[model samples]
Target: MESGMFEDEFQNDGSFLHDEFEDGENFEDTENETSDATDDPKRQGWLVQIRNLNGEVTERRMWAKQVPKLPVTEQIIVPFKGNQPVGTDIDGLLGQYLGRLASNHKLLPISFKKWPEVVKTYKDWVWEKHIKWEPIHEAAARTSFMMDMGKKWRENRIRLFHTKFDQTLSREENIRNPPLSIPPTEWAAFIDYRLEEDTTKKSKQNAANRAKLTINHTGGSKKLKRRSEEIMSQIGKPVSRGTLYIETHKRRDGSYINEEARQVCEKIAEIESQGTVPVEVAIDDSLGQVKGAEHYGRVRAI
Candidate 1:
């Protein structure tokens, strides 16, 4: 369900605003600008395409005045408009502007197709103001700001699609349609079965490593020979350096019984009870000089 759409279209790095407007004719660093365009009607507005809270986008012409009091929230996106002063108020402006885009569809939660009904409802809402003025003001300001700039009201509807929106949609779809139900007892049994299977797999791997152990008695050193003899006496077999002898008194389930490990431990305890401590035998030095059957690629006549 992971969609690469937003990541493909919009760069998630903080430099999105910069990259988005880099190719535009009016691109400028809105962050460093000092002059306030908040009240300036002569300022040019930008026809920005932004994604809103409800995952829908439509083109809106925005000026610095429209987003002056916009709130800083995750639901909105603001494109870099050169004439607009983003300053420290970018977050809020972005949020309000996004909310405005979503407002026409979801804010009031009522549909009125007739123009008179829309006007009457708007007038009634003007008195109540439950649907905060910020979104309304932003919408009105964007329209007025665009008109003041002498730009045509083009129906050039543009949708701003980000990858994150797809994921959000997927999550909502999941909430609407969850996975099929499993009875509590069967679910618990399934979990226990999985745990047991994992434990058995690990135990088998450990058993395979233990099976690789072999007794070696090839070293010529006296100390190694003595130690090797001690281990051989205890295990009734030869012992050598790197030889593995993994014995355990208890099974993996923790039940204890006299096992190979317990017998080995008893023998070692008996050896230690005598003065000489058992040590590992070293490998034969001649083994290092032994050549393999395979030869190098070429040989010289010398």
Candidate 2:
């Protein structure tokens, strides 16, 4: 289930999840800059303007009725209220976009060890290029951006180590013939780090812990946030978190991860199939609230 458990890809390495933060580093100003020249220049700081988040975009969508027959595949850009989203979450489209850049190694830090500096550099790069995404609160945006970039960076590092480290060749040979992208010195350091005694010990412990779980999910690499957005756009309606879980946690042969998962999905599905949802929470009026949502309207799996 989406909330009940995390995807195994994210939980693969303890080192990636927990890294030592570089101290006393100066962070660049991550304020959301105005893309529109018409915007008041006086208001160019931490607090940015917002919109009406009172109801769902669907209900507020004047074109919903007029465009009912539109192809489901046709992409629609729904403008959400609260221009500056509350709290700190990097799981939105903005984060996903930046995360893609991170995965591609386009978004990089000055040094892997200088965590704060990396966040600063990343913020500068994004703000300069993406004025359209200039409404998220600075703290929230930077924290999420840094984390997403860091995770992807670490994962990519490990992937490179696995794919490039040659078993047939000696360590010196491998280090000398570094990848075109990586610097010779950095590559050598990385190789040495991987072969270090403490690093190997920690990796073994993490692997042992990961092996404790018997049931790995069938869902691929897509995060639930993106998956839910796609579903909502396709159906032209919101779906419950439980329903989302049932959709994702199923096997290729139309079976569930386990018997317990089957039971939960069945129960949640039954509830969703019923028309017991209130009129106020209609697809057009309100974003269909996930059946049992918690924490800033996010849903949890049973």
TM-score of each: 0.15, 0.52
Candidate 2 residue spans exceeding 4 A from truth? 1-100, 103-119, 126-139, 233-238, 257-302
Q: Tens digits of per-residue lDDT for model 1 on 1-302?
A: 00011211322211112111112112112121223223356644444444444445455555433433333221124322232312223433333333332222222211232223334454334222322222313444344333321111111100111211133444334234321332334333323432356745964787798787543222211123233344466789644222222222334354334454454444544543453433332122111112112245531100
List, in order, the clash count of every candidate structure. 9, 1
Which residue runs of candidate 1 sit more than 4 Å off their true CA positions? 1-10, 13-44, 69-302
| RMSD after Cα superposition, model 2 | 16.0
lDDT by candidate, in order shown: 0.31, 0.45
Residue 177, candidate 1: C-alpha displacement in angstroms: 67
lDDT of 1 at 271: 48
